[model samples]
Target chain A: MEALFAIAIGTLTSCAVYLLLRARTYPVLLGLTLLSYAVNLFLFASGRLVMASAPLTDQGLERFPDPIPQALVLTAIVIGFGMTALMVVLALRAIHATGGDHVDGGER
Target chain B: MNHLPIVPILLPLIAGSVLLLSTKWSPNARHAFSLAAVVGQLAAASMLFVTVREGPVLVYALGGWAPPFGIVLVVDRLAAALLVLAGIVACASLLYAVARDTETSAQRFLALFQFQLLGIQGAFLTGDLFNLFVFFEVLLIASYALLLHGLTADRVKAALHVVVLNLIGSALFLLGVALIYGVAGTLNFADLARAIPALTSADAPLARTGALLLLVVFALKSALLPLGFWLPRAYGAAAAAVAALFAVLTKVGVYAVLRVYPLAFGPQAGELANVAEAWLLPLALATLAFGALGVLAARSLRIAAGWVVVYSVGSLLVAVALFTEGGYAAAIYYLVHSTLASAALFLVVDLVAGDRTSAGDRLDTADAMPHGALLGSFFFITAAAVAGLPPLSGFVGKVLILDASSGHPAAALIWSSLLGAALVVIVALSRAGSAVFWRTLSPSGGARAPRPSLAALAAPAAILGCIAALVAWGGSATAFAQAVGRDLAKPAVYVDAVLGGGHAQPDDRRRLR
Candidate 1:
């Protein structure tokens, strides 16, 4: 199971890096979103995977997943969401103003 | 700890929110309010600095929760120094901005500026790694909007580069935090120091990778050598007032490096001992050389100022790579000097750039100024200070750095590079100065030159005055830096203060299920 998750993360990151180098803004934005997804997953896995148990404070169980990484991932996800939204708006504005979709706004 | 540590973060947060809602405020009223708030911040931070400058670490655990549970803000002399420096720059730039801005929408800009301060101050004070991430986001988000305040095409383009690069860096910061927590089971710096010593090799790769990733994140933020491509363009595009405030922003990255590398992964950190020093030194030296070349190649004064900022970052990191008390003292002194001098440079360039409309910031063109000689002297003094000429704060700071570098194995290389970078700067800036100011000097030469107003001159003059204070009080400031250095060298005080001196670790953390 861990191997599967690792492989997925690796694939996502490789694809993200490849797309990040593209000339257009949309592709780069998509790449950032995908990269963020990978990062979020990595953050989630940092808690060490658990099955069939939640680490509720009321229920003190020996077999419970660490809760901190969940909080961390949730925070990261919210931040990532905001980041994506900002990037999207910035991209659209760049395209509208410069009449170009290239990342460098096509020769200023 | 008193309420002082939290005050630095809270003051700005409150002011920012108030200013954000004050849309009814006239531009003048808004400027007054913003100035009042920054004055409050400076006062609070000054108090904090005085309290911690030569005293014990002040730790404020939010909600009264101890380490590993609640967010912790640990303010030592180092944090106090950065806080005070940031405050000074913020205050000076506020004056700079308020005097020139005529639009009522200045309220929003002021609000954003306050929030930026909040983020920067929080980043400096926070003892928890995850909190640092949150603060980084706050600063970056605020900066993105601030960079686009004027909404020009060039500014927007530059903002895009800065935003995208910083967003990626944020993701990496998250990755690093996650990896660190995965290995250490805690995000608190003190806890990490404790945990790192006790860790057996659980792949060992995880911890090392995490450390390096954190370093990379900081490197990107500091605009370290290869990763610094975004700096010149983004910063050069900013208005001079905004650029002046940004002078301290790069130093925040330097502060983080100084804070993290030594305490969390210092010599005593078993698994991650000396991780960055070996790699950082050579890279920093290379950055200096590269930045010097960039300075020479720059087409515009604004562009050259940006390169000078980069050059100072390189110089600060060179001291950081030394990883000694003397090195850190030198670094801090240089950090303070460079911040004031470079900020003054940006302001000076702005003053100069406005005179040369046809020249349009190019170094080759010389347009006459209304008071070309006075402005010329200002430019010369500011550039000379930046280039480390004698009788300036820059020289004093460089002397300390040179004094600290003598015993290092790469002493000769360091010395030569230090002198060489300064020489290049002197030559380039002098040439640009001569072309822009002296060669073009005339009693009545250019029609487009605006009269040099007192408001226009006030901010840079204030900045130069501060640099002069640094020089006049150079001995005292050096002593303070030495004290800061001693404090940094003994991380035990920090770790203990955070964890409640001599207190054992909190036992709430359990192993992975």
Candidate 2:
């Protein structure tokens, strides 16, 4: 499961990097979204992949996943959502104001 | 004492929400509320710094929960100093905004400014990695709005570029956080410190990959080398006050790198220090060279302001690449001086613009209040500060960094090249000085001369001049730098405050679980 997750994250990261390299604004936003998912999962997997176990423990259980990473990842997901929304709105506004969505041709 | 650490962040955050609700009210009321919040924040930051100076570092856990399971706010000497600096900058910029005749509505401007202040203070104070990300987003969102406040064609173009590039950076930052979490199973700075060493000892590949991801994310935000292309454009196009506030933003990124890299992933961690020293040194040199060249090539005062941003990024990376106590100290000192100087330079540009407009009207008057002479003095003094002239704060910081690089041959080379480039910068700035302040229109009689409004804009420049003078005097400022250095070199003091012990032993971890 960890191996699969790692591979999936690597794929997403590469895709995100490629899209981010594009000159246009929309693809870059999409790229950031994909990257955030990969990051969220990567953070979740850092606790060493406990199978079918939540971070919160039941009675007499010897171990569970680490609660700390779960809590951190939850915070990150919310923050990531906020950042993505802000970027989308800003990009749309930029297009309306500047009449161009390309990052390269803007005034220096 | 525990609760005091969180008040600086909480006050502006609550004020921001209230301001959003009160948008329907008169601009005066909104401005008054925002000003009150900023002043309150400044007082809170000052109180927090004094309290931390008197005691051990202050730690405040959210919801009264312990660390490793809850978010924390840590206030060490370094964080405290930075918090105070952010407060001062915010206050000064707020003052400047109130004085400017720009088209931005006061209510909207103050609202965004206060939110940005909240975000900046939060980033400095938060002890959890995820919390850092949250505050970073807050800061960025506020910055985007503030940058677009004036909504010019040039500003819109610049803001678009800034948004797109920063989105890429944010994505990478998230990826890095996720990767580190997957490997270490904790995101609290203190927990990660304990968990990373054990993880790296067990599996080298995981630790190496995670460290590299984080380095990239931080480099982008801090505007290191190739990733810094977006900064000059975005900062150059924004209003003077807005640009002044942003002068401290990238430093937050640098602060994160310093805080996390040395404490959590140090030299012992799987080639981490080596990777930083190796690639970052070359990047630092390249950044310095590029910034110097950019400054020389710039045609307008606004464009030169852009190059100053590049110069600051270069100097920051120099400190980071040195990776010594002295190096970090110099970096911290440079961070403070550069932020102040860059903002001052931007403010000076606004003054120059005002002078230029008045000069354009005064075509025929030969002795019409030598606006050019006043500007000439301002530009020369500012250029001297930026180029690290003796007796200036910039020089003190640069000398410290150079001394820190004494033993490292590569670092010394990089430092020397930077000195040479600074000379070139001095020359370029002098040429700009002549063109901007000395060069005049043809002597053909055309129109009546208009009086210059030097009094209106002199306040910001005078404030910067006094700060530069204080830094140059050096008794108290030098002592402060030494104190800050001691605190940074020994982050154990910081970790203990947040975690309540030096390290979390295996036994303690078992007990907690």
Candidate 3:
């Protein structure tokens, strides 16, 4: 299951990178969002990919997933949301001002 | 007083919140509040510096949580010194802003500026990798807002490039952290120090790949060579104060590279350590050559600021390449000097621009020496300092770096480049000065004398004073560099502080899980 999740994230990251390399603004923004999601998941999985339960305390349980990475991912998720919002606003403003959404505005 | 370590970050954080809440207030009130906040931050930073200098490395665990689990703020001598510099620059720029009436949307700008300082301070002080990323994002976001404050077409365009490039860097950084955490199972610097040695001995490839990923992220952030193309464009297009503020941004990247690369990978006590330096040295030399050439090729004052970015990359690379205590000291010393000189130069450029009638014609008019003796002298001094002439802070820092790198072949190349670049910079800046401030205009030698306002004069004076102080205290400054170099060389101080001292056995590692 952990391997599957890692593969899935790796695929999404590649897709995001390709889209981000495009010349259009909207697709680049989408790419960033997708890339951010992949990053968040990847960070989460770094704690060794627990499937049965969270890292919360339980009676007689010797081992559990690390909680630090989870906490870090939570923060990243919040910050990532902020970043995406800022990018969207910036993109919309650029589109409104330039009347186009291309990265270099066809300047070649 | 024990809690003072976090105050450098908290003061600005709280002030920004207050500024946001007081959005409907008069701009005067906002500017005053911003000034007060910066002054307070400066005070807090100074106090923290004193504390760190006098005591053991100050560590303030966030929310009272210890390290390796909860977040921690670590204020060693080096971090404290940087905090002090950031506070000073932010305050000086704020003063200039107040005088120029450039404090548009004063509350928002001040809030973001404070947040930017917070982010810088956080990055310097934090002991956790994830926290570093958080601070990087915070600083970058604040920078994006600050860069677009006036929303000129050039600024917007430049800011778009900066944001896109930086976002890619940040993504790479996050991926590096993820990979490192996957293998090491801890994000704290101290824990990583303990965990990495064993991991490298067992699986060198994972460690090497993670280290390389981090290096790329930092190189991009520091504007090294090819990855640095976006910096001059973005930074050169912003307002003077904004550009001056950004002078510290790339240094943060250099600081991270210095801190992480040496501590984590450079001293791994195995074959891994040998391979790490081999990769780092060439990259450093390339950065140095690229930066020197870039500065020579740049045509405008703004473009020159871009060159300074390159110069910093080169200087830092010299230290990393040499990988000696003296080399690291030289790097830290040069870091301090470069930040001050660059900020001073940018402020001077802004002063010149302020007296012009239009942005395009600003450089043209400034060349006419409209500001008279006072402003001209100020400009000459700053330009000289930035160009690294004798007896200035820049010269002192460069000499220390060269001295530190002496006797090594890499040092020889770096020193020659340093001297050659200095000569070229002096020539370029002198020509620029003559063209912009001393040359008589063609057709009619009678151009209107630029009557710069008192505020314009004060701004550069403030920055120059800071530079002068650094130069005058060159002895202590070198001593400080040596101290920081000692600390950096002995990563044990950091590891001990972060991991509560002692090695983590394999059983203990399992217990941590």
Candidate 4:
């Protein structure tokens, strides 16, 4: 389970980096979204992955998952969503103004 | 509990909301409310500065919840001083925007500006790591809107880079926080400090990586050498007043470095003591040299001003990397001086550029500006101050840094680089000044340029006056900076005030479950 989780995050990050390094704005935006997904997953898994366990429990359970990472991930998701929307609008604006989609607003 | 610490954050938040809700209001009314908010913030920041100066660190718990379980706002001398600095910059920059009609030209400009302030002040005051990230997002988002406020092709391109880069920065910040929390089981800064020193061997490596990752995030924000290439172009493209407010933005990164590393990873952190010291100085020096060269190579006055800001950050971090009492003091003093001078420089650049119809801030000969004498003098004084000339606060700041570094092992290297950068900056500014002001073609067609209104001149003049005050009150200012330095050296006072022993419950997990 640990290896799978780590490998998933590693793959996502690598792909994100690749897309991010592209010259165009759309690729960069997609890369940012992927990167945010990896980050959210990493944050959630930081709590020491537990299966089918409630974050907080009143019953006398021997083990329960930590809750803060969940909260952190939730916040990251919301912020990430807002930022992605902003980037989309900004990319559209750049394309409209500069007549190109390259990050520098000039076609290579 | 004294509520002064939270006022700086709340004032802007309220003002921004008001401005956002009242879209039909007159520009005059919006400007009045926004300026009033900033002025109130200045007053509150001044009172908070007084309260924390010789007094204790003020900790304000949100909703009466204790630390380690809930978020807290901690204001020491450093945060209060920065609060005061931010307020002053916001006031001047917003005033300049009003005078230039930049704010009225864009939708929701006033609200976005206030939100930017809210984020800055909140970042300064928050005691939780996650809370800091939240404020960073707040500020970055507001800045994005503000950057594109007067939308142009140049602005859109610049905003794209700034936004994408910062989004990546945000991801890194989150990853670092997660690693730290996973290892230490806490996000509250004081609790992390308490927990880090006791981390087991296996956990130490994870914690160390987390700390270093945080350093990357901050270095990027502060525009340190390798991570800062986006700065000059971005700042150069921004509206002058937005760029000026952004002069404080880099310092936020510097402030984070100052606040976090010392408290959480100081000498007490066993293996992680002074974790950032190794990479800080060399990169800082390189950044300084890079900035100086960038200034020399810049073709436009605005870009040169941007490089000047980068140069100042380099020097400020060099002081911080020294990790001594006097070093922190010098860094604080330099922080104040550079922020004001750079912000003022941006405004002055705007004014100079506006006065020239054909030249448009390019460092080449053109028809002479109309307000040549007045604007020329402003540029000269600002350039002199930025380049560390005598009889100015920049010189005092440079001297303090030099004196503070005298005891370090790399004193020779530090001295040479600092002096070399100063000399290079002087040569560059002089060349820029001559090209813009001195070597000018006569006005074509004999059409004299119209004079700028007093309102436009007043903002930069007010900020320059503040720099002059820093020099005139050098003794007292330096004394205050040293006191702030001393306060930071001892982290126990900060931790105690935030956690206060009896208030923090160690077993928050069990209590929650």
Ranking by TM-score: 4, 1, 3, 2
Cα deviation in Å at residue B203, candidate 2?
A: 2.5
Task: Provide the TM-score, chain A, model 4.
Answer: 0.95
lDDT of the candidates, in the order given: 0.85, 0.74, 0.77, 0.90
Clashing pairs in 4: none
TM-score winner between candidates 1 and 4: 4
Arranged by lDDT with the best first, the candidates are: 4, 1, 3, 2
- Estimate the overall C-alpha local distance difference test score of candidate 1: 0.85
Q: Which stretches of candidate 1 lie over 4 Å from their true place?
A: A55-60, B101-105, B441-448, B501-508, B511-513
User: Looking at candidate 3, what is the lDDT of residue A9?
Assistant: 96
> Considering every candidate listed, which one attains the maximal TM-score?
4
Give a tens-digit lDDT track for model 1, residues B1-513: 478788889999999999989988777787888889888988988998888876688889899887767778998999989888888888887887777544313778889999999989999899989998999898888888888788788988898889888988998998988888888788898888777666667735687788889888898988898889889988898877788888888887788789878887888888678788877999899888888878888988999999999999998899989999999999999999899988989888877877676675787645565667788889989998899898989999899989999999999999999999989998889888887876664444446666657876888898889888999998899999999888878888888778875454535465434
TM-score, predicted candidate 1 vs. hidden true structure: 0.97
* Model 3 C-alpha lDDT per residue in residues A8-36, reported as the tens digit of each score: 89998999999999868889988988898
Which of the CAPRI classes, incorrect, acceptable, medium or high, describes model 4?
medium
Q: Candidate 2's error at B469, in angstroms?
A: 4.8
Worst 10 residues of 1 chain B by lDDT: B504-513
| Candidate 1 lDDT score at position B350 | 79
Give me the runs in candidate 2 sitting further than 4 Å from their true place: A3-7, A10-18, A48-56, A105-108, B268-275, B358-370, B442-459, B462-466, B501-513
- Per-residue lDDT over B288-334 for candidate 4, one digit per residue giving the tens place of the 0 to 100 score: 99999999999999999999999999999999999888999999999
lDDT of 2 at A33: 87
- Report the C-alpha lDDT of model 3 over B1-513, residue by residue, as the tens digit: 278888877888999999989968888888888999899988989988887775378878788766666778888888898898888888877787777745443668878888999899899998888889999999999999999888766777777777878887887888889888877777787777776776745566766677788888888888876688788878888877888889989889888877786677656535457434666667666776666666667777777766766776676677756777888888888887788788878777766655443332233433344453565677689878877787788888788778887877766676777788677777767766666666644324444645666765676687788788888888887888888888877888877766674435445665756
If scored against the real structure, what TM-score would every candidate get? 0.97, 0.90, 0.94, 0.98
